[model samples]
Target: MTTQQTFARRVFLVAGIYGIAALLPQYFMEAQVGRDFPPPISHPEYFYGFIGVALAWQLAFLLIAGDVRRYRLFMLPAVVEKLTWGLATLALYAQGRLAVFVVGFGLIDLTLAAFFLYAFHSTRAERG
Candidate 1:
């Protein structure tokens, strides 16, 4: 209904989606790491580590979304991080050199990050 609530919901949804998606890479990495799988089969460790980081990032937002005010300190950093990733993804996509699915998902993330930033600023201003 309200802008704040909508933003919170969006954050939760994005975080949850990304968190779940991160797990899939682990399976792929496991299956192809040491076997005669593919060229990208030598770095399962790094992929697993990245999945861990993604999981943490997503869980943080999921935890904070319910009480954004209590976790206000994290808002700016989260927005900045997401925006940076989104822009990089967009740039890669624009060059016609990125995974199409990744690029499309990044576009959605970019939009959500922008909206979150706007909502955060507006809420802060209102409070001030």
Candidate 2:
């Protein structure tokens, strides 16, 4: 594999691993998060649903990591996924609706989004 593809593979792999590590605990931390973040979760469904969908995307990231050339197309939505959460969180923080600490995760997502974009562009010569 070329250096670019290697970079993409590593990026996705790390993202997937990191996402799983971060999200999996939330399943059991609903109460703690509510206490720490304030305003107890009023809707359990939405909370778990978000975790489920996010967890699925993490799996998708791992899948893409397994085959960067073949799954290059998926990089697009992956970027979107990062951006949606990152931008929304940052926006909320800007509006004073979210804690400053949460901005760290948002920034991480945005950074990863940039890497994902670069990875996608870097593999343009690869066979789809």
Candidate 3:
């Protein structure tokens, strides 16, 4: 693999692992999160749904990592995936509606989005 491919692999792999580690526990943390964050998550469907979708994206990241070239087209949606959550959290944080802790996680996603973009650019030559 070239340097770009290596970087893409690492980026996606780390993102996947990190996402799983961070999100998986939330399935069991509904109560704790409600206690800590307040407002008590009135809708279980939305909360669990978000986690489910986010977790799915993480798996997709791993799939892309397995074959960056073959999945090059996927990088675009991956970037959007990161941005959706990252931007939402950061925007909420800016409005003073979210906690710093949440913003921190959002920043991570934003940073990864940037790297994802770079990775996509780097792999352009690999596209067949």
User: For residue 22, what is the lDDT in candidate 3?
Assistant: 97
Q: What is the C-alpha RMSD of each candidate to the true structure, in Å?
A: 3.7, 0.7, 0.7
Candidate 2 residue pairs in clash (backbone atoms < 3 Å): none
Instruction: Summarize candidate 3's per-residue lDDT along 36-91 as a digit string, tens digits.
Output: 99989999999999999999999999999999999988999999999999999988
Give the range where candidate 2 is weakest over 10 consecutive residues by summed lDDT: 119-128
- At residue 125, give the lDDT of candidate 2: 86
- What is the TM-score (0 to 1) of candidate 3? 0.98
Off by over 4 Å in 1: 1-6, 21-38, 126-128
User: Mind giving the per-residue lDDT tens digits that candidate 2 earns over 1-128?
Assistant: 89999999999999999999999999999999899998999999999999999999999999999999999999999999999999999899989999989999999999999999999999998775
User: For candidate 1, which ten residues in a row score worst on lDDT?
Assistant: 32-41
TM-score of each: 0.70, 0.98, 0.98
For residues 53-93, what per-residue lDDT tens digits would candidate 1 score against the true structure? Answer: 76777777776676666665676777775787789988988
In candidate 3, which residue pairs clash? none
- Give the distance in Å from residue 11's predicted Cα in candidate 2 to where it truly belongs: 0.3
Q: CA lDDT of each candidate? A: 0.67, 0.97, 0.95
